[model samples]
Target: MDIEQIRKRAQEIWEAEGRPEGQHERHWQQAEQELSGGGELPQTSSPAHHSATTIPEGRGKKKSDAVPSLGGEPGGFQPGELASKKK
Candidate 1:
């Protein structure tokens, strides 16, 4: 029927398909197809908001070695020491 109706249908299909990984393209294309009504949806050159490869795998590639420490350990913050300064 209308664009909203078609998009709703396509979204339902996308959700039904196990919400599979790397399915953003499929979702966008299907949404356009369902909403286009035989006329092509105007294409935009703007980059897609969500990129598939950006999803990190595993616990995060092992961090490639420990992260550079910000400062000293957590206990370095002496409790109430900063609060004393305000008074």
Candidate 2:
């Protein structure tokens, strides 16, 4: 991948998203994805959706819910269990 092309595309993405702060990595990844012909990035309807902390309605889970396991287990393991198992 061309660094210059990626930089230009990232700048375009940054400008298109109103130049929000602290999103350099995301913009760079998106630019790379586009330049590599992976697929077009999904367009957001509003600039507010660009905030990293803004979880969309109906998409977030309650804190009480079990986080799903990567191994396709029924009930997920506790937070520290995965690392313990690895060791």
Pick by TM-score: which candidate is best? 2
CA deviation > 4 Å runs, candidate 2? 42-47, 50-87
What's the number of clashes in each of the models?
Answer: 0, 0
How far off is model 2, as Cα RMSD?
14.0
Model 2 over residues 1-87: C-alpha lDDT tens digits?
A: 999999998888888877878888888888888899987763432356556668798776665356544445544455557655654
Worst-scoring 10-residue span by lDDT in model 2? 41-50
- The candidate that wins on lDDT is 2
Tell me model 1's lDDT, rounded to 2 decimals: 0.54
lDDT of 2: 0.72
Alpha-carbon deviation at 69 in model 1, angstroms = 73
lDDT of 1 by residue, 1-87 (tens): 576776676666566664555755766676667566657543332233335436565756553344443335643433335534534
- Whole-model Cα lDDT per candidate? 0.54, 0.72
